[model samples]
Target chain A: MGTPLPRDPIADAQRNWERHGWGDVAAPMAAITAIMRTQQILLARIETVLKPFGLTFARYELLALLSFARSGALPMNKASALLQVHPTSVTNAVDRLEKAGLVARSPHPTDGRTTLIELTAEGRTLAKKATAALNSEVFGNSGFGADDVDHLIRVLGTFRRDAGDFTEE
Target chain B: MGTPLPRDPIADAQRNWERHGWGDVAAPMAAITAIMRTQQILLARIETVLKPFGLTFARYELLALLSFARSGALPMNKASALLQVHPTSVTNAVDRLEKAGLVARSPHPTDGRTTLIELTAEGRTLAKKATAALNSEVFGNSGFGADDVDHLIRVLGTFRRDAGDFTEE
Candidate 1:
């Protein structure tokens, strides 16, 4: 949804160190620290915006999963694995989504202790709308052209895969 | 510093939907949601590891910034801008970094209202050690290699400059 940083030539590197708490550190560390700091700043802004919609990143993730499904449904256990969260977290998230009327949980056809969570039509519609708004609200401000956005996705995708993201276990 | 995500891709998608409220979203929207999710997961994991050290991402960021600066000193305004936070967040972050004996603040040179902050040697040394540990924690898990770490950094770096960052007034 956004692009890279420092719209202006960045201020002094040494000054950045003092500000971010690296205080006279090297360039690499300074750069990393700055990234982390900016990351927090951006996420906080996104969080506040999503708050009014009753959506957290966690909830949004769940909805995305269901919408992508061919039948718009998946088993609870299956969803839990993909999110990399504990079963309990998945349970809680699903409960909230269900309450919001964004997803429906039905008895699993084949698995015990697992339910099938699917997006209702209304849920699907909301997800579509929110997706656009989320894009505009979070990254749209950057005024990224198609290529910039595409590059960001490809890079982030590589990053995610490289960051020791868990495979199905 | 990330927890293992479930192997189930379906649940993973569902998690996005539930948390972000997305359904039938475009690749761009899905991509942004995924990036945001990973950041949270990574930060949470980082917080867990750093907890025993009495540090958070914010603290680590400050320490690293200071460690990179000249004699570990810099002015206040730059800190706010580099960290991409309100001046107040910088103020509070420094207050904590100072109280922790990681940083110190002094009167700004020739400026009555401004201040300068610097990291102590203890902070600098500690930052190095903590970073080493952090690197291992990041690398030693999830069956990822240094190449993967490098790739991840590259991708994240792409986003770092690609855009979507908000500016402060």
Candidate 2:
């Protein structure tokens, strides 16, 4: 790398907060800021790995979602809901994926007004290869050991639960 | 809210991965995806709290940074570096903050080619008030107990450190 990425800025900010007599707020600020920066770093890394496959993380997610569908296809509306994204985003992803010859759109078999997204043979093959690449390069070695990974999920899960992401038993 | 935000989609996706015989990747994917979604949720919450102050989270961050400066001013390049963002983003943030009367720009006192960003009196006042609002409304109630917050920071810190966010001690 030309220049190494600098040390965490939030750490410096936290010190600054303490100096300014705002130590009470520093912990939460540092936590949130780190989460945001970590997201950026992870996305950048994933995108880099997907670049050679002509996929951004978003596109890769769409392909992977399609690949996971039991019928190898899903209604656009269902895709939108399942992906937890807006309808326009799903539509846009499909448009680009279709242009890339990785997926196709057709009228839903049982619903006249519904559109269905189905993967092409090329799309299926690409999805598998991309998955393998991501597994080895990004997912498999995200720098967190298995215990750390489990802890992260549990910690973040608490926030998600409180935000109404799901009701706890 | 008309309907509470639905359960975290990533959790559902993780389950789908297991059902599809990709359980091996589910743990890492869940951890990463939950982190990504949590970032979005936190940003949205922060933005909402900052809305009444006529600030987005990015603008609020700039104000807070200036407020924390020992000299109450910083060079633009320094702001970019400390903020861990591109120079163009610093320029953009300063431009918006200036337009909002929260900050002012001037030539550096001793450096001919450097520009300095200083918080206006109004900016200082707003920064404090905004900090208070965020502290009580958003940051203070981020859904993580103190222990969980500490745990999240430690776990995410590991990833950040390994990703070259900072050098190890």
Candidate 3:
């Protein structure tokens, strides 16, 4: 804890240079690299638009997921896993979602460290509106059909599948 | 900065909540919802593995782009535009890359605000190896293939285009 991060150039550089080789660094950085950069640019562009709806992307996601969920809900752990974050983060997100009245948390009834989250009535109404709005923005009027989407999901799933966690080979 | 950020409750919660909802928070944060979330998670994982390399995703990206360029170089502003980062951020990234001996800079013949970047021999050599390794990790016999990748990219592009970024849509 003394050092927030390593400082030994001689010692740490080798360790830091672990697997992210020159080859990977040289590639399209987009095709195989992370999507955060592209998204960050877009996110900033979209913020002003979302302002009128009183929704942040996260809240919208919570509402969207809950609305799409089979039971209109999910356990805390499931949500966390689905969202790809640590359990603690899910706990915090759910807590906020609860406060916003977009979602509610209940005892797991199964696991102690787990909680169940479901959308509130208000949450559902807002989520639907948001989803529709989101859908429109993503596709525009070109009207690329469901088949295109299915194919895309399939391919991307592969991209993600092969990529794994981005750390392990 | 007038304010580190605005006192927007909705925006704040969205930013925090996104740590979970978007599926991964491993990348740097940005206001764009989909792009940022995707970037954060993928970058997070890649960077985690890359920590041993003493490189941030930023530095890695610089290497990758230069390696991919036919001339083994690009202008600072071109790089910034391509990466969706500010010109200053591009300058900072280049400084780090130059120090690492992975890339070099030359004054632009055309633009004063621009600097040309080229990968070093060592940097070029290293980048090739890293990309192969990363390709293996992402699609590495993952039971997903080119068809899958094609489908996925199309879908994601569609989604991003349709969604118009995370913040507004």
Candidate 4:
């Protein structure tokens, strides 16, 4: 990482927004921008942990999701929905994983039009190892304090729900 | 966006973690995953606003940064540092902006070894328009509530500070 800046760049950007007569939206702008930066920080950390396992965060998420499935498989569209990623992204991840012998695509038994993505034995093993590493190296020591972690989950949960990510039951 | 899921996927993932004997790390895992999902949601909104201007968030950030510079220019390295992105990413943004006639690069006047990136008039104008659109469509009505906005700013500020993004005075 570069040396810590003398000041928060987002704060400077917020000041610039205010100076430009955007006082009304400056805080939201800074908050949104902070989320972008924080995602970058967290993704970098997560990716580092997953790298040795030959996974990007996207691919790892797919593997982890499958690993949690009772049948160790899901229809492509269902996986896409659960992952909140585009179908094309799921397709691409499946392609990579299949090439790496971590997953396979098979015709859905009950639906000819659907394809099921099944985690291979190797995929399950890798997912377990990767999760263990992430649990220990990243999540177990996530940078946010305990209260901040709870706060983030609640706040971002609200934001996500507002964005139509899910409906609260 | 896809149809709203029946439940929060991150919450489901946290439960899965807890069931797997990762109870201690489950909350942090969910928090981080929520952040990842939140960033995706916000970025999609931001990108839609930026799309008509032929700008991505990265390029918009560079244009906005240079527009705020007193000279409408900054050394390329300094721009990267201030933006907290890698120098290669700054270079890539510069390449696209230059091709679009939005920014130009020149040898630094006093520092022969440094390259300076300056916003062209077009870049400045586009940045203004893009910022106005984002302010109106996204920032002004950010999915976050007003109180949540302030909370995000403070909470994320602490996280960023701890991550070495800045040294407060």
How big is the positional error of residue A37 in model 3, measured in Å on the Cα after superposition? Answer: 8.8
**Two-chain DockQ for model 1:** 0.21
DockQ, all candidates in order: 0.21, 0.53, 0.08, 0.84
lDDT tens digits, residues B1-169, model 4? 5799889999999999999999999999999999888999999999999999999999999999999999878999999999999999999999999999999999998898999999988989999999999999999989788888998999899889988999984
Alpha-carbon interface RMSD for all candidates, in angstroms: 7.4, 2.7, 16.5, 1.1
Task: Give per-residue lDDT, candidate 2, residue B12.
Answer: 74
Q: By lDDT, highest first, what's the ranking?
A: 4, 2, 1, 3
- Root-mean-square deviation of each candidate, in angstroms? 7.1, 2.7, 13.1, 1.2
With candidate 2 superimposed using the best TM-score fit, by how many Å does residue A10's alpha carbon deviate from the native? 1.8
Candidate 3's C-alpha lDDT? Answer: 0.54
Once fitted onto the true fold, the runs of candidate 4 whose alpha carbons sit more than 4 angstroms away are none
lDDT of 2: 0.83
lDDT of 1 by residue, B38-128 (tens): 5655667678777878888778766766666665687877666655667887888888888889888999879988899888878887787
Best by DockQ: 4
Top candidate when judged by lDDT against the true structure: 4
TM-score of chain A, model 2?
A: 0.90
TM-score, chain B only, every model? 0.72, 0.90, 0.64, 0.97
Tell how far residue B9 is off in model 3, in angstroms.
30
